[model samples]
Target: MTDIRLFQGPELLDHAVALHSVYVDAFCAPPWNEDAEQAIEFLGSLRVAVRRPGFTAALAFGGREVVGFATAWTTLAPFPTDRCYPRAAAGLGPERTVDWLCGAREIDELAVRPQAHGTGLAADLLEAVAEDAPDGRSWLLTSLRSPRAMSFYRGQGWTQATHPSPDGEGIVVFLGPRHPAGALAAQPL
Candidate 1:
């Protein structure tokens, strides 16, 4: 059996750190060559505001351990991600316009411990996040080079944005809704 917990207040801080560690472990350096230690610190620092509205951490428990987790938050008219500028630029380059500024849900991290994979833990965490999204739409950007991540997202019914993100290597944007009308399509993965 499995259970999920949505954190708030001081508990939000501890769980946020745990989720960051999981993210750094799962995402790795990949095509960007991110340093693992740095990634952990960078993402962990985001806990400051995640204590507020929209941000949340969902942990999937397998007996005494946390087997899977997710970290995400909502974006409104002004955009909360600007605060993540320094961190985002580390891997994603310049802000180049916060496309989800008008309002959208952004998933920063989702991870499941290797020992707990294939138990529907990740999907369970995602479902909980999706349910509480600012709205039903969650938008995220990923390295088009990571087929594993992209394929998993696609399997969950996330569609690539028609418009490729504005970047040198071109990160693919996956919108959880109907592909955003005419946003631009991605090359086949």
Candidate 2:
């Protein structure tokens, strides 16, 4: 049996190491190829991210070990000026991007251990982290290279957005329910 735990704000700080370990284990494989040093840097970034408004996280445990996890927070109003967000915002355009994402929850991370794959843990963690979004609005970005990941998101009712990630990172954007993008995507061609 898998046990799942939900964490918010300050409570997330306590599980920082465990979360990082899961992230490193999950992303360091195949398409991501992130190194331990990069994972540590991500941990540093996570420390600040959890402090943001509407931060939330969920973790799945197999016995005493972390097997999967997810994290998210509300997107910024003007959008972020740093990293790939600006490029992503540019691709989505100002109005739709802000309207759908500004106050909407953005799932920042989701990972599952190799041994725990195909056990439905990822979906459970995703649901837990996104369950509290106001009006059911939520979104996320993932690599275009990960077919399995993209397929899983699609299978879970996530809609792909027209915007592409900046920096040629092969990033693909997805919007959950109640997002304007979903309506746009559903319209007849």
Candidate 3:
């Protein structure tokens, strides 16, 4: 059986190395094709992310070895413009972006070692980070290139709020099942 632990604030840095290992194992191949530099960059970003308001993380351990992990934090109002935030904002438009995502819990990362693919560890980790989301509102952005990931989130009842054009080469946003905007997500833009 796998043991999962939830950590909040900078204290999560205690397992940084192990989490980095899991990240590389989960993302450094095939569809993701990430590299050592990217993993190191993630570690640096994680240091900053842990300091964000309402930051939370979950680590899954299999006999002391980290097999999966997830990170999340409360999104603040005024909506950020960094990274993929613009993509999400552009997709949802300013009003819906503020209403649905500004104060929601945003999942930043969810990675499970390849060996743990079918063990339900990912779902557990996701739930652990999101369990205490404010007002049960949570959201995430994922790449449209990863069909398996899209399918997994959809199976977990996350509603895709963005649909990419036919080329399908961009990111998509998802609202948690309990989010108030989930029903409104299906409405025409």
Candidate 3, 61-173: lDDT as tens digits: 99988889999999998999999999999999999999999889999999999999988999999889887888989999999778999999999999999886736579999
Top candidate on TM-score is 3
The global Cα lDDT (0 to 1) of model 3 is 0.91
lDDT of 1 at 121: 81
For residues 1-189, what per-residue lDDT tens digits would candidate 2 score against the true structure?
A: 999998888777788788888888898878889888899988888888879989988888889888888889988788888866865676578887788788899999999998888888888888898877878889998877787898899888888785454344567678885565687753213
TM-score of 3: 0.97
Model 3: runs farther than 4 Å from truth?
Answer: 187-189
TM-score of each predicted structure versus truth: 0.71, 0.91, 0.97
Please report how far candidate 2 places residue 172 from its true position, in Å.
Answer: 1.5
Better model by TM-score: candidate 2 vs candidate 3: 3
Ranking by TM-score: 3, 2, 1
Cα RMSD, each candidate: 5.0, 2.5, 1.4
| lDDT string, candidate 1, 1-189, tens digits | 788988644576655555665666555655445677766665555655476557776888777566778766765544445544333334323343254323566676677876666767877787777665554667666665666677787788786653344354546656675324214434445
Clashes within 3 Å, all models in order: 5, 0, 0
How does model 1 score by TM-score? 0.71
Clash pairs, model 3 backbone: none
